[model samples]
Target chain A: MERILYGDNQFFAVNHLSDSKSQALAVRFKDNEAIIRTLDHAREAGINTFMCTTHDRIAQICDIIRANPEKYKDFKIYPCMPYAHKYANAMTDLGIAGTIKQYVPGNLFGTMFKGGKAFISKDYVSIMELLIDAEMKMFKGIKTPVIFLQNVMTDLLLGLGMVDLLKGYHDYIITKYNAEPGYITMNMPKLLDTLEAAGISNPIICASINKVNFRMSGGKEIYEETLRTRKFRAIAMQVLAGGAIPPKEAIEYVSGLPNVESILFGASSKANIQNTVSTINNFDSNKV
Target chain B: MAVRVALIGAGKMGISHLSILGANSNVEVVGVCDTSKLVLGALQKYTQFPCYTNHSKMLDQAKPDAVVIAVPTKFHYDFVKDALSRNIHVFAEKPFCLHPEQSAELTALAESKNLVNQVGYHNKFVGTFQEVKRLVKEGHIGEVQHFEGEAYGPVVIKKKADTWRSDPSEGGGCLMDYASHVIDLINDILSPVKEAHGTILKTIYSSQVDDAVYSLLKLESGASGLLSVNWSDETYRKMSTSMTILGSKGKIISDANELKVFFKDQKCPQGYSKGWNVKYVTDLAGQVDFYLRGEEYSSQMDYFINTVTGESPNTINNFKSAWITDKAIATIKKSAKNQY
Candidate 1:
């Protein structure tokens, strides 16, 4: 993981704070070139790692990267699977078979039947794998050092005691993609314990790490204690706590943590990217 | 002289062609494109040839003399058309495309470019089927009156409701994958199917698409036939294709291995008076360099290679025949009576 990883939430119009800003963003980044241009800006700011959800638009972004390999040779992507909104919208628009036809790979019906059955039977582990493969299809030839299970499914599994699935996902990333597995969750502490219980140690877990207890299950104290003592690679996200904390204070609090490995943030402009990068870097320099 | 070929779709058939086409010294497997990184990554351990997951991206780089499409029948048009637009030749799998209009457009494009196009109706070159064609042409069967082509298999048995072979959108189902060969065989011997009336069943095995398709086809040569195929037939050992043809004078029974003819004192090829004459596939007149999947797969590639180099003319399941197959299938769909 890079010290500062660029996120795709801003590009996809996912504002944790305001609906108006998100709507503006949806209009703003509707053109894929706008997303690509912002990604280039992030690259210029020395943020080479793009932590993104596997939305349909990301396919276009992958195409841009693949088409111009010279420009993106050293770049890496952390592709998160089961972009829930995309699938939910697809199900609404195209219906069940149509959604499966669009997502499932290889033998459409053979794989889809399993996926559909898994959904009904709550054998979500197999469905997760299929969804991963389906999601991984877009970034086929691109460099993806880490593939993530998005929070919508990841936390659901966490809440459901589906630890076997966590292990399965972990194993698949290593075996199929030859990449590290990442899990994003709301309750990082519980997820870590489940993963550790399931034989996945020193895992990469992305969650809300901030000054306030904004969406931080188990509270800020527990998060701080886990950061200090846990044997895991912690990628801090939602550090600004949906704009509750000031930028400087958020960066300072998260950067000064004991075991946080990486900071994931999203920005629409060059200034915000530079500011975040500089703030984190300045905090690190001042720590000594 | 090597014919540079880029193969798209690294499914089971793609892998088969990869090994077979690689075995060909006269052809270069320039690039292999599939949507699966696992498949492409797996290919890297063996061959140093270029591999990609996107066809257009691969085409931009490979720029080969020809393209081979071993993808599902649904994707035939786009990949084939992409290659044809570049004035490059293409060889696609059966059921040329999902629709007649697209098939006509691709056929016209390929023809306008004068690019060699072949579809993988490997049964056409199967020795027994070839013999059946030969026997029919020689008037041994004597003006075929009707034929029944049946393709039953365990491929989609037990409601294989979730494979590309079972999805209607993906150009799956028993008819597209299995029955197309028998249809093409009838077309090869008699004439193209001009129209069809049929019933397609999706609920027999609870498939997303039709698991079983039964149809009566009207041939251009004024012959009519029945096609009974069900992918969900679990009684079969595996896949078995058998065609029974009844003619004015005699009849022919053909399967994968044996060609049987029962003559009513018809044209006997210096064999006997009036009885059943059966010849196995080993009695075929030609030999292949190598046999993978079937001799026809290699023969098809070899023929395509030879055609590319001007060694042979484009024959055996060209795109026009594929177009007719496409039209016939569309007609079957349009003609099937609603069960509601």
Candidate 2:
């Protein structure tokens, strides 16, 4: 049975998904003395789980986590990798000839890679092994759990095979490493539906809400299906959608959404952080 | 007896006070004085009260029960002193005097005359701060630990480069211009501070006076405070007052607009133990309504009239409170560049 806990039952999970990847993390990371003290302020506000894209400056992330050992003891971190990392070894084993950069753009751009071309990507197995190994090493001796968030864009191609690929890399490291596997949902509910079709059930997924990619009807169906079939843990991404939404109105809008455990946002300054913190203070699960 | 009142200096603030006093049924504004006939001309359209070009003429002709002194900061001491000398209660707008000695003189004069004296720090009567004060008094935020206020908006200087405010002769810097609100905030939350460190910046604006001010106030009860007053940025006009009170058991954070209390619920550490629930009450908007009424003038005017008619048993007919604002402004001005 899919464990679908709701309404103040699960920990609130927030991911720093500002689209700038490493540069964004470096700018917002606490130890860098950035204008916005994201990690420190969030920890002070008692956010339990934090996720971000793998930054080039992993040392700063590690230093921040290490410095505030007790303060962020319960907080979890999830690192999101680009979609291309999946095709490394599989295509090579299959005698496919191409540059590493060519295969990555295919996975990132949905129309380019599908069916045979996606399955035959030479770097798939090698990239999976690399990611699993990096994660195992990155999460070593960490008392708080580390989770790998799999993008739910291409289940027929790569995403559904993640558990098996992770296992093949480190001999059942999927279960052995005590790593949590989460998924990020595209606007298409069929992607999630395909996960169930591939016997990959109960995936924890983060959903993005934005102008260009929002299929609310599809989102609600997938959310309900996830609640019924997969783990219903959701971190609301794209809450502000690149600052297009006013902070206060965005907060009120997010708080009104269903199945939202946490909202991920970024700030440019301390004042922004303070204002955001105040806005989030408006969230009342009971009202929802 | 009619509730006679005279407005000293028929300027912007004086005009506002006169209008508010005129609106109130209990007030009868008797006279108005201004050095400029233009100011008197504007006052005449607003009120039929006798207008004088001199303070002595206005006070003598009107024999006003109370006086509203809206003159320049430097002249506050002399005008307030004159008003108190006649045993007339004084309702003076902020920065009662530029110097502590001048303020002290006014305070002594008010005290000696037993006049109903009140200085304008009208923000205390504002709705948001009133709610915060009530919450603090009710132990909603625990023991008040820290307070930080930031009032930043576009610069609003009505005069030219050679204006009195820029001359320092008229006490025109941000320390006097902006510190009035900060000082009132300090008075409301923490008792008057014994010592404070301040820094002023003349950046961004073309005027000779400081446009930005940052001050660190050491409250009598050891609560630390920071008041950052800026007049440069135009991104948004925001006036925010926040107090974070860390008590032995719980913490209360008052954003001046709303109150958030962090007390441990009896419930065990569930998944949602650390989150906050927001309550929306409409008390804050109501306070703004009360302040917009210029209720200070009405209250002070009524008290002055009541005292003059012996309707009230006791009155502040002297200058005690005027000196308090005066000294606070002087201290802030003196330490304007001293950063802590």
Candidate 3:
């Protein structure tokens, strides 16, 4: 796991802090070149991995990376699956069958047949795998050492008690994509228990781990206890807690935690990226 | 004792409610009802809760203390009425009913039965919006003179096949689906829109229904504002609802995620400064037992379930408030018809 992972939120205008800021970012990264520039800045700032959602625009990013294989040979992307809006918009544009035919990666007829079978038999796991394949299509020929299931689907499955689907995602990613499966969830304690019950040992989980307990479902103390007592790899995200905490304080808090193998953050500027990287490195060195 | 709850519709929002209800320690999901055999089969296979195709059958057998209705807006009237008449607490999804009259009737029925009724305008549960309400009420942004409520999303960027969301009769369109949220937030955070004029329901993408809604509104407090909402905005990754209120003393800008307030002088609320003060949803939002898309989603369900269990007062997001929103929607629709 990379010690620092750059997230895609800022590039995609997913500002959890201010709408105006999000609008600014949306304008700033309206072009794909701007996003590429920011990635290059992060790479120069000593970050190697980019954790991003499988938005349609990301497909273009993947194409750019594939084109410049020499420049980004060691650059890795941890692709998160089921960029939900793409499917939702597609579902509205095309019906269920149409969406499946459009996105699922295979012969059109075979994909349709599989979709039909899954629908009829209620084989949700199969459908899940098909959707995974479809979402993974964009990351083809890229270095995705770890694949993540976005929290929207992960927490939903957790709430539904559908741990089998989680396990299915885990095993399928390993066997098919040959990447370690990571679960991004708001409820880390419950997800850990579910993963344990599903026999997914030492799973990689990413969640909001901040000093303020922002978006930490079961609260900060529980997360701290789980990190101390658990065996799984943890990736601390939202360390700044939607800009509520100062960067240094936030990174210090996350770095002081046990079993946190990586810290995930997003910034659009070179200065912010360098500052965050240095802060994390400083906190980590102090801990060591 | 736990509140025995049954769910109807079992669509996207319905399943979300069912999941939250399933996780609530104060509630037990007694039955699930939906017309789709596929959805019911999946539920039956995975969950221990009983599943039924007929809502009436589910209601009769489950004998729930409360029921959640998440069907299409057009069906909300019938389903909610049935649940209310059964002396069951009801939590129905938003755009409470297709027409204001139906919403009024349901509101009356629920009130007469003394049953707990809630409409899922989940934005009210958003912490930043809640803080907006507080700041406005506490006169941090004194005397809101003008305001603007806007919501945009990429739900329908292209000319698409007709779904329930594309049909106006089914309570689709930007007016009902998107603008209603902003209207409700304006009503809750500031004041109810008393009148609307210069309304324009433009069909940018959808053939049958309006894709964007623009109007000038007058609140009950005589403060006026603008309403601009479009569902065809591809720039937004999802629905982004925001409100900007300009006042005599200060100003406020809020969205689902954050709240920003500008006070002119030192006469500001505690923990807030004279100049620009910003608060994020993470700082304002309360924790929930189970979380999905956002804390607001689970928080709304938790509030409804708590109200059903009599643990909390049925104050916020009641049917009456939703009726106010429906009336505002009707005002906009009627005003749109008179556009030049």
Highest lDDT scorer: 3
Number of clashes in every candidate structure?
Answer: 7, 25, 0
| TM-scores for candidates 1 onward, in order | 0.54, 0.48, 0.95
Q: Residue A13 error for model 2, in Å?
A: 32
DockQ (Cα-based) per candidate?
0.01, 0.01, 0.50
The Cα error of candidate 3 at residue B169, in Å, is 1.5
Clashing pairs in 3: none
Summarize candidate 3's per-residue lDDT along A171-224 as a digit string, tens digits. 999999888999998899999998998898999999989999788887888999
Candidate 1 per-residue lDDT, tens place, A1-288, comes to: 789999998887676543345558888988998999899889998899999988888998899899998989999999988787655433322344555556665674465355533232233344557778878999988989998998866764554344666788899899999999999876788788879998888999998888876556656788899988889999999898766678999999998999899999998999998999999999989986
Candidate 1 clash pair list:
A107-B164, A108-B163, A108-B164, A109-B162, A109-B163, A110-B162, A110-B163
Q: How high a TM-score does candidate 2 get?
A: 0.48
Residue ranges of candidate 2 with Cα displaced over 4 Å: A1-288, B137-140, B157-160, B238-281, B284-322, B336-340
Sort the candidates on lDDT, descending order: 3, 1, 2
State which candidate, 2 or 3, has the greater DockQ: 3
lDDT of 2 by residue, B71-128 (tens): 7777887888788788777788776677778778666666666667777765564444
Model 1: residues >4 Å from true position, as ranges?
A1-288, B198-202, B271-273
Native-vs-model 2 lDDT? 0.52
True contacts kept of 2: 0.00
Candidate 1 displacement at residue A111 in angstroms:
16
